[model samples]
Target: MRRFTRPKVIPLLAKKPPSQLPHLSPIPNPSLPQPPQNPSPPSPILTLSHTQNHTHLLTFIKTHIKNPPLTPKTLLHFLKSKLHHHPTFTHLDFHVFNWASTVDSYRHDHSTFEWMVCSLANTARFSELGCLLSFIVANPCPCSDGIFSCPRTEPIFRFAISAYCRVGRLDDAVRAFDSMRKLIDGKASVVVYNILINGFVKCGEHDKALWFYERMVRDRVKGDVFTFNILISSYCRNSQFGLALELFKDMRGKGCSPNVVSFNTLIKGFFREGKFEDGIEMAYEMIEFGCEFSSVTCEILVDGLCREGQVEEACELLIDFSRKGVVPRGYDYYGLVEVLCRKGNSERALEVVDELWRMRNVPSLIACTTLVEGLRRSARIDEALEVMGRMLEVDMVPDIVTFNCLLQDLCNLGRTEEADNLSLLSSTKGLELDATAYTILASGYSREGKKKEGKVVVDEMLDMGFIPDLATYNRLANG
Candidate 1:
């Protein structure tokens, strides 16, 4: 975490080591091609003071390695260790790395520079990070000499751009992006632009992202599907549906077919803008375009329409589309089913579940619970019991709330014996009764003045830590 300070120059009377070591001939000059070799272990370092002079540093490397003709691998290993172990002396690492790069026998590879940039970025040392990047831009790595140059440059700048943008240093990110452009062989690819566009959008610089997209278009860099998707998603987020639609159309005109995500975004936007019908129409259009429906499309259509109080329309659209094989199978329609039951149309809801069941679509646990509660609320206790039976048959266990509702409803109707029987039935079905279920039965017994039966229920409730209210105690006492 320490800032970079210029190391004071110390004069040395020792003779300067040859920039090219004299004795070793096995190590290929980096200026010439060399077959790859395994990297060697680092030289032991006792202090940073010995490394300030390139002469002493080169001699130190020559003398310390156990076995090496001093290949780039060995030199990189040595330098990386110093940087890794002695982070406080990173200022010296830059110099040692530069000196090693100057040696014809060893040049810094992409990994070396990348490690340096990553270290500087990770440490939040932006001043050194910028200087190192500038150095990379000016003096391309020796391996990046000819045909191999542009490809290697991409990752370095891409990493730099991502790192810079992550810290909210948008200006530095842009500079790195510009440097990346100058290094590529042909027109900058959509991928590089996508990185910058995504970074700008992530930083909430949407206008800047659009501006960069415009620049990309003007520069004749063709946008890909990802490019279109990012922009459309951004436009949709900024409430610029008009612009989003325009871009969607523009992408198609450019022979870039809209994908499912494109359709989903625009459709969701349509719903958000209160254009539910338009959103549905868009879903149909997507199907006609051979773009498959995703789970999100189903959610948007069903949730959007139901929220607008057109639950029946939403359900019908799904069933109708599903029958035609337009909407993808296996989309969770439980929410829609629950919404229907909640709207007091439990009979119609049950019918819908039957239809789906006939088509081999099993009801979800929530759908079963919703139906049970809805039937009880409608005073159709027999139908509620039938739904509960169906739930048990399907292995869809009812939750405590569902059990409580059925028991409370039975108790409310002066059917204490039936409620007690139902409680026993739920236990046989693995639906454990909670304190609320016992209290409901106990209260029901007290109301009927069945002192023996009621006293047993109250004792059971008390055993389960169910403290009855004073009213219930008085009723028991009076009974």
Candidate 2:
């Protein structure tokens, strides 16, 4: 079967209209509020342009009408499939929709109304969207004429309301919501109320969000967990921790289970209030409630406690969490290690790394590097070497600069053979060895008077394409 390809649309200014295969038109029209009926006459240029657009639309529609009378579905298909993608014609969607409304025979259904609403909304055309909403409100979907309201009407306005809220047009969003509630058969869904509340919250209108929440309750609408979460976070943001606590309790009484977000919010609120114990206590409560700990939860706990100079407590908490296997594997615990090392407590940092590593919670490369540098600074070479080996086994290699520094340390202490082994291991483990790495090892072998080993190191450097100069290579290689 041959595939049919849509022809490129002709430019609006082009005199010659393109030859058309088949296209589209409309069926019925709904009278709507455009400009006043007895308005000023159009200019000749706009008149000509309008006539050309109308002629183009009519030509396409007449050619492509599959059934006898074009329905809203067919019209919508033409809008999306044909005109919507066109550069010049795309902006004329509303005009074409108006043209459809002019057709006395075809009445639009929800499909057409929703398409236009979403199209206007997605383009951030609020002024035009407001007019479209007025049109939708004045001409309710035919389905609303039945006993039950149009199920789709609320969703369309819901989308529009969200769009309005996104642009901080809270007033317009409320107006749209009120209009939607009137059109729908019953109370609006809790989700619509939540959107309005969230919109207010996002605009820093916490009081308004609360007022709206009260209105929702009085309207006999029930908020789900998501609704409670939004309000809870808003309360915390407003510095109403006491009220936030009360609302949290009410949430439990209402059988809305607090998720990780709920806990994280309150925990952060506690930290802000300088209630360290309370913050940590609530984290423990999260465990009791069987809520999975999020990475943010750990951050709040670690950062909060450490900020208050309770670094050891933070360390204990992380280790405890790891023992219970409750720690997120992706968490590196680098912050705690850095804090510990910064406080001149590298001993504790070492223990923390060792304990966590033994529990199979792998340290990130930075964590391993940090821990290694801390140990080396405190001259704990044995422990640093142990950590390095374990990290290399897991394919967690540090950058070459760090490896070279550690090699220099080991070689200065007469452990060049071990440094040589480390260099070899890091190379095989994907850490590219620079000339300095082999030079350090070569110098160490020279100091130890191991000419065979020194020459061997020089030979390995040559094989790896790292020759400094013939004289330098000869002096070191002959040593």
Candidate 3:
């Protein structure tokens, strides 16, 4: 026992070697504050996401809602208040609706679903629309008492398909149309097919539109005027005028009378195909059918004839139809007037304007402005001033651009006094003078060697925060 003790004492006496000591981490700074063992919960994330839709919806409802227990009426009001006019933030409404579907406390009513679909469709959120439709189809509203049915479900699908066609998503539109048939209570309305046909036509898939029309006919859905019109327009756009005329005849045979739009489409098609005579014939035919000319019909006739260098014919047609009360009021006769003015026939332009004025169809400001510009260009300054006076008497003040033209003409002719008087008169008449007016006056003064007047105008410009360029300032300084 003594020998063993001596042997151990030889190692223990050296005081454990440095390598034999236990390794330990360095101690943290005692002056620094220690982190909390349990930190406060993170602030709720303010995010718009599908996964967090329920949480966000609850948060929004708590902030904006007022009723103790949410009812359809109160929820609808809350939704409309937030979503009705705010087109950009409509996704929040969808999120709320989605969250509402999960709750048994309330159910979405018919009006709510209709409004949501309309809002989504109108805003062109077709992808969201598709998802919404799927949700409605899969999980019908609880208000129906376990019946997964909606009266307006077909209409909503129809709108989505129509919108899809408008944006060139033909496949999605067709899929929606197909899905609609299974959901609708009765046979799909012709309006639904008409929408698809029109969409195909608008997207330039003319053959596909025609094919879809055939499918509608085969499906035994009674084609209406809208259905025939879509086909006619599509045929016309594809330059298949023969097919368009045939469809027009078929529309009549089927007892579906053509309206102003139908005739206008054919007439425009005729003009597009360089068949002006055919277009004119179509107009008379429209009258025989008791269809009054729409504004579009008048524009087509007048603008088409004018473009074909038959301004005189177009003018005569306009006057004749206007007197007969066939064309709508406010038809643009100025197109013909502008054409005459461009031909340096200001006399004819003035005559047309007077004729319209006598009929109590006062010319637009653009009409007066155009005539004044024409007169000025032809060096007929006196006539231009006369026209300007007429505009004022009619309470149609000249725009700044027209006023500036007159001022420039006067200054160029060394009539600075007249220009200055006109400026004062314009301001009195409520035409706010801009910096250009003052600069024009100053330039005129400088040109006429009126140094005092020029200096005063420049100082006014400077006081108004309009610093002239270096060259302009040097000229003003010299003046």
Candidate 4:
């Protein structure tokens, strides 16, 4: 109380100087409702109703959006969500939508538009794509930048071209591509050009593809791995392996490294053309390029080796593949087994069967048949019988050819009783004992000077509706 009463009410010190006072923005009107902070998800103006008859889906689509304009975006969405998803829908739906126009929509989103084009193109709906394209040409969508450019248009257009190409509609594809050129200002994308090239390639129109490829380079579109791959594959498909290899060299010369697919294509082409040496060499080259040989590559090598009577080498390769913890593909075993049997390498063929068994992979019907034939060819009658017994035990019926081969081998080895038992088994197994089987039995009896048995076999053969050939008749008469 001493100085409080008289304490001068000195002016309160300002917490912040007027010069340093934080400038406050005036608050906006709180009364006005704020616009939505985020955009609403787009609602489908058109909803699909399920119907048993697919024509109803088309009818529903047509009725809801009369004169519906088609664009790449709309087409893409429709294809992905509607047409592709509902494959049960009638072709009439595709036909109707294919012809629909996208002109009603004043502005179409570019990505959606591109997707639609690609979708239609993918489905081979060229006629419908063509109609939409005509609309685009007449009424180009305006650009936001006011430049009136259509960069996205080219991709969609290319998709249409590819579709046309897929259906062997080369003329249509060409027309679509040419029209696409008019839409974009600068150079079209290499990807687009490659699509056209692939179209040509697919139709076995290699010349056309090559022509377009040259044009692509001339138009400054850079060639890529896919471009070369398409050309190589096309060449190989046409059995023009020489031309394909030449192109491979040229691709490398142009600084493009050959990919595994490229090499694999070439190897397959060589093998198909019976250029086994070249195929094998390319396989080695593939390994040198640090590319692991695929099962297909291995199959080709094994097949080539077998064809050249190198069954031992083929078997070794199979063993090596197994040791590397690689299960031989079904084709590999089938090829090796067939060749081994054909070349009278039954022992090796049996070893292969065992190896496949050890690897827990069952031999194919072809492999089994080949093994049986090989055993018969090499006069391994007992082994052939063992294989047949195993086949029956495993619920596998011996094919007619395999059964005939085994019967002949048994008769030739003077195992007439076993051959007769096999005949009974064949009839029981629903297999016909054809002329070959009876001929073998007749020959075996004749060689043993059992005229009564040989004559009985001949009468049985005639009763079975098989007309014994001169060779069989002569053998029986001589006995």
TM-score of each: 0.68, 0.86, 0.64, 0.53
Off by over 4 Å in 3: 1-135, 138-149, 376-386, 400-479
Candidates in descending TM-score order: 2, 1, 3, 4
Worst 10 residues of 4 by lDDT: 5-14
* Model 2: lDDT of residue 297: 92
Quote model 4's TM-score.
0.53
Q: Which 10 consecutive residues of model 1 have the lowest summed lDDT?
A: 6-15
User: Any residue pairs clashing in model 2, and if so which?
Assistant: 23-64, 24-60, 24-61, 25-61, 27-106, 28-106, 29-101, 29-103, 30-101
Off by over 4 Å in 1: 1-105, 118-127, 203-207, 326-343, 356-364, 407-479
RMSD of each: 11.0, 8.3, 19.4, 19.4
Candidate 4: which stretches are off by over 4 Å? 1-105, 108-128, 141-152, 182-189, 235-243, 253-255, 269-275, 304-331, 353-479
Superior by lDDT: candidate 1 or candidate 2: 2
- Residue range with the least summed lDDT across 10 consecutive positions in model 3: 4-13
Q: Write the per-residue lDDT of candidate 2 for residues 225-292, one digit (tens) a residue.
A: 88888898898888889899888999999988999999999999999999888988998999989999
Evaluate all candidate structures by whole-model CA lDDT and list the values in order: 0.73, 0.81, 0.73, 0.67
Greater-lDDT candidate between 1 and 3: 1
Per-residue lDDT of 190-286 in model 3, one digit per residue for the tens? Answer: 8888888888888888889889988987888889999888888888877889889999998999999999889999999999988888898889888
